[model samples]
Target: MKYGVLEAATAAAIIATSVSLLYTPPEPSWETEVVANDTYGKFVEVDSYGSNVGIAYVDSIDTGLRLAEKSYSTSITDFSAQRKGNWDTQVIDNRSETGMYPSLESKSGQPSISYQDGDLGNEKLYYANRQNGEWNRTEVDNVVGGGTSVGMYSSLNFHQSKPVIFYHSPSQGLKMAEKKQEWSKEILEDGQGWYTETSKCGNTIKVAYTGRNSEQLKIGEYDGGWSSENTSTKIKSDLDIDTDQRCDEQLAYLDTETEQITYKDQDSRTFGDAFFTRLALTSKGNTTHLVYHDEGTGLKYAKKKDGEWTTKTIKQGSETGEYNDIEIDHIGNIHTAYTSQKKVYHTVYNKGTTQKIQSKTDEVKIGLGLISALLLIFTAIRQEVIAKIIQKIGEIQR
Candidate 1:
């Protein structure tokens, strides 16, 4: 009675089909989608298990990552709750410099975030967490460490049910902190806009950064001591990075099993005018998803799905995909959060699991729902229609 791991995207569909029949769209389509133009949504991040999906992104003008969530079984539509801090109104350091480059990770059913805050240019890192319906804030590091520049651009992830962050300090280059009884920090080397990839074994914490002195890209493995090297030519000045994601010259990947960093073959695999990179290694450890931009191509997605490398363009406009983040849901659906045309769009590929068949009865409900939704377009009432649709189909399938 139970299925094994999902080796193929189609295999996951088999599990879905077993649960209930589906109507696969003839071509790729945005079944349920939304884009927000009013808010400044740069550096977007999303995580989900089943129906519970959470999103965090920077409202640059608002000075922090806006948090939202949707906890429904069937609908793949807009967020149900936006800016959901009402559980507690706890505020963190809200200076002029506090809002940039926020990172988010959801674990143990709660989302934890990290960001940089300070006066003018004197920056320090801080963490905010919500649990048991209370939002709390803490300072992970102080500015007194001394730096070549301010310590900013943080990546937050959960390792062994504990909080860990990889952050950049101009004085220290690349640094990492893990939350235990208190926060413990480590200085690995000197670099900027570094990416953190923790091994599945959890014994090793791997990092990749834009090399400063050599101008080359570098990578290292940290486990209570030093292990890293600068092994390639200098990278271009233009680079972008996100959680476990960085794209630049002297490219590389980490072999977590062996705890070694493998440099990519740049001679063959290359890009031009690389902007930003969003990376996601699937929980299965078999596939890797990367979304990035180039001068020639606007926004692109590359994935090594099922041992084959394939790529497609997600956005074709100029200067798109500047700050992007990606996450895979319970099923093998791929969802991306990227800024294009100065607006943040959530591209959903919800073909297999979240998306379901359009039965005759279901289509009628959807048709009627659309009529009601149109009357309430651009208003809060539309969200109510979406909820009914989700409940309608959820009950039908059950």
Candidate 2:
């Protein structure tokens, strides 16, 4: 005598109920802090050096460029990893409507920022560096006349210890400004250079940007000289680029037509799925990490290692991951800055298994394991009962 279909269905229902009652999802293993509040972080960039993390962002309330710096303790003995010492905020530039689209980098434990001036008739590019307890500002480039903007899409990096900035010019195309003695400028492409991102590997400085005419992806490499090439990939809203120690380029971009987050390396391999604009990317050796906004599921952190991609949601909200920036520290911790509801937030992911929080996928796996074990036991008991019934019947017949 075997179990009927209704009995099987009831057993499945019981197993499901048992799993639901017995298993609990682990808590998220990340911590977040509010860096700024109430429209202070419109456009942001984050960078880390040693134990210090710095964020540069546009404070829309004061219409200024702001810097937020915090130092984190890396000791895991006390479980006090999220103890980011008080975030100190400083006004880098507060003139009339400045500091839109800022790129920040930490050099020698100090923050250096490149930004766009938003004042009317002063759509200029500016750089600010902190030294001796004060900030020194320099005008890197400016529009000669009144009708054009020159620095909105600026990407800043250091090449040979000198600051090099790649920026967009509405009338002039893609341009680069290098600060050796005085700021010298050169035009890379005549009618291109939108949404530029820059990274350095030894003496090589690479920039990834969007072409103005075709709206496609383009790469500009600067070793001894500048050379430009076009890629078949199209750019939609935003993109980021980084380089590993091997000088291999790791790039992530928003696809023009699909609105998907597409990643590519020097070898031209691609990964990722549908996501919204404004992502940040960083790489170390064979591991690449990205933080992007998913239109359906909020903010996500994705990692690609050994040719496989594993992604997890960092925060869940409609507008959480917009305007995000990511950085990897020397010891392999991940730090990110993002904006949600017009406020800036900082989050960190520390490496190691010290934290016991499991992801949602892990919870599902645990539930499935429980169900499988229970189903095996139910089948084994049912078969034993059937064997006993047949034995009794055969004994009576004898």
Candidate 3:
């Protein structure tokens, strides 16, 4: 009877221990925070300027969606009021408007500001500087046709210690213009032929966009001259080629490590549901990190640590949202902002801690399950022994 009672108590204890282990609350972890309102738009740059960090976005305001700036520290402030409007607006208004707005580029070592002028066309580039809490605008490129259409893209690269702007004109293919000797030179004469997205890594320029007749993502390298390659093996019809296919591509580098490009391709009917591709290539002293986004899966990242594409998903599901802008700081920290359900959200990945925790949780769950099974087997053996003893005792008593 005593042996049976002890066995029963052991089983109860094992069951209770298993229940406690399984029901414990998960440890809290860092999660992406919704920093702004539910607005559909683009967040161009998050500049760590002045005494705090300033975020810039190009979205609809009173006179339609224009570029705006907001400053945040421990507190958030609308610095947009200090600026008249976005760079596009200033160019449209003939550069007469004043105040702080958004600019494609800012003069280095100056309080960042947006510039605009009437002499500039709809496609204009301006250099802005802030003096004594006020903004000064200067026209960097008076040339016409630099801006991309809505949902399209363009980029400015400070290559070889010179500012070069690469953009797609409506009918012109990919064009490269260098700001040298206070004069601009159109290097790529065959400008508007294929879709093009350009980014700079150190001194290397990486351009990726779709081809004129094919859906493949065409990539180009600019060292001394322009050399091109196709990153995607799929055909042109397999991808979603925009009206002006030349402008739909996106390109960016991962920190200062290496250049990478991410763009949309529609291989199947499932492709149109996915619109944006965020890619990053990072080289640790010389390592490459490639990250991309697909409609089927939200955010996918790849790394070249030992010299292969080691890929993983950062986020999954459409609920995570789309239209992501990724930036890697000097210290190799990644910050991404995207629109999910019409709301702007920001997420930062710090040294892969999130990845480590997820791995541990998976392993722990498996280990717990195995332990529970072992306990169950032991409990069964004990119960069987107890039953045998009880039977023997009854026999003896009879």
Candidate 4:
């Protein structure tokens, strides 16, 4: 199916769901489960029909929306919906592509979705709305520089009551975009460091990235406007090392009422290699957290409970590990995904239980295969003894 047709059908379904709820409301239910994953530079959107739903990612070669559909447990039908490129193409020419990074976030309280088209030359951000079974997309910003890494290389979030974008600009440092009449303005500009990580809660934006001169990891928060830029408190710790780069970080508010930012920091332990490090706020708007790692003794968790930096390893493992991602759900559940020994793992902290999910199916299969081999060896030995008895009888007859 073409991209346009798939979106049209989805929009129709959404409209149907909305209308049905208005007329006869009942318990909330999920109509379908759709999974989107990228394979070989193509965005594959698979629907519940157990078939390939032909939805393509918008780019220069394949512009606009495409779609396909399948039935419940039935084979997917080879039908599609597509919309050809017919928008303001003169805005930017995204030809010399270095890297294309796409980030998607749904607008709060509205049926609108925003995505960033990060290309080498024409780096642009866009917002699209689904109204009455049609999609209307509008360009929000056209970032200059063919080499600048714009858009969400780290994280993207929608702040309630205000539409703001927290992203890293190669030249503009850590920047924030506020919704304006047509285009947004860059609110925070730090000359010392380049912003590498960002997350938003309400109107506050927390950023973690490498700093200038020393290249140390720094965390900052933005609120109201640029006047709040100086209010960002830097976390201090003895675990901090020079020449270390913050690869990835995630921020979440500890308490929704207090609006405190609790973030995880990944720092380079070696001169060239990096490891996972935990940090938390000591006080409201204060910098630094209790810091520790798992490789030393036990599971490590650091927190700034009152007004001092504390460090303690909470859970310890023999092997070294690094945190890949961290998310705090609506119910104060901390979900952390990490990597250990080239295997992806997840740990969820909720209701005082830490459930560890690991990828060890391959090892289990190998153990079963070894046991089967031993059984086969025992059967073959019995057959050999029977053959030897038959040979002795033939010798007596000769």
Which candidate leads the pack in TM-score? 2
TM-score-better candidate, 1 vs 2: 2
| TM-score comparison, 2 vs 3, better candidate | 2
Cα-based lDDT at residue 353, candidate 1: 36
Which regions of candidate 3 fall more than 4 Å away from where they truly are?
1-30, 42-55, 61-152, 181-195, 223-292, 296-320, 352-398
- Per-residue C-alpha lDDT of model 2 across residues 9-41, encoded as one tens digit per residue: 557857776676677543326778888888654
Question: For residues 355-398, could you state the per-residue lDDT of candidate 4 as single tens digits?
Answer: 11111323434454555454445445655776899999999999
Q: Residue 177 of model 1: what lDDT?
A: 84
The residue pairs found clashing in candidate 2 are none
Q: Which pairs of residues clash in candidate 1, taking residues 3 or more apart in a chain or in different chains?
A: 23-357, 147-171, 148-170, 148-171, 173-190, 173-191
Q: In order, how many clashes per candidate?
A: 6, 0, 24, 29
Can you rank all candidates by TM-score, best first? 2, 1, 3, 4
- Runs of candidate 1 exceeding 4 Å displacement: 1-28, 31-35, 39-41, 72-96, 146-149, 191-201, 223-226, 237-268, 271-285, 354-398
lDDT of 1 at 349: 62
Name the top lDDT candidate. 2
Per-residue error for 354 in candidate 4, Å, reads 11
Overall lDDT per candidate, in order of appearance: 0.55, 0.79, 0.44, 0.36
> What is the lDDT ranking, best to worst?
2, 1, 3, 4
TM-score of candidate 4 to 2 decimals: 0.38
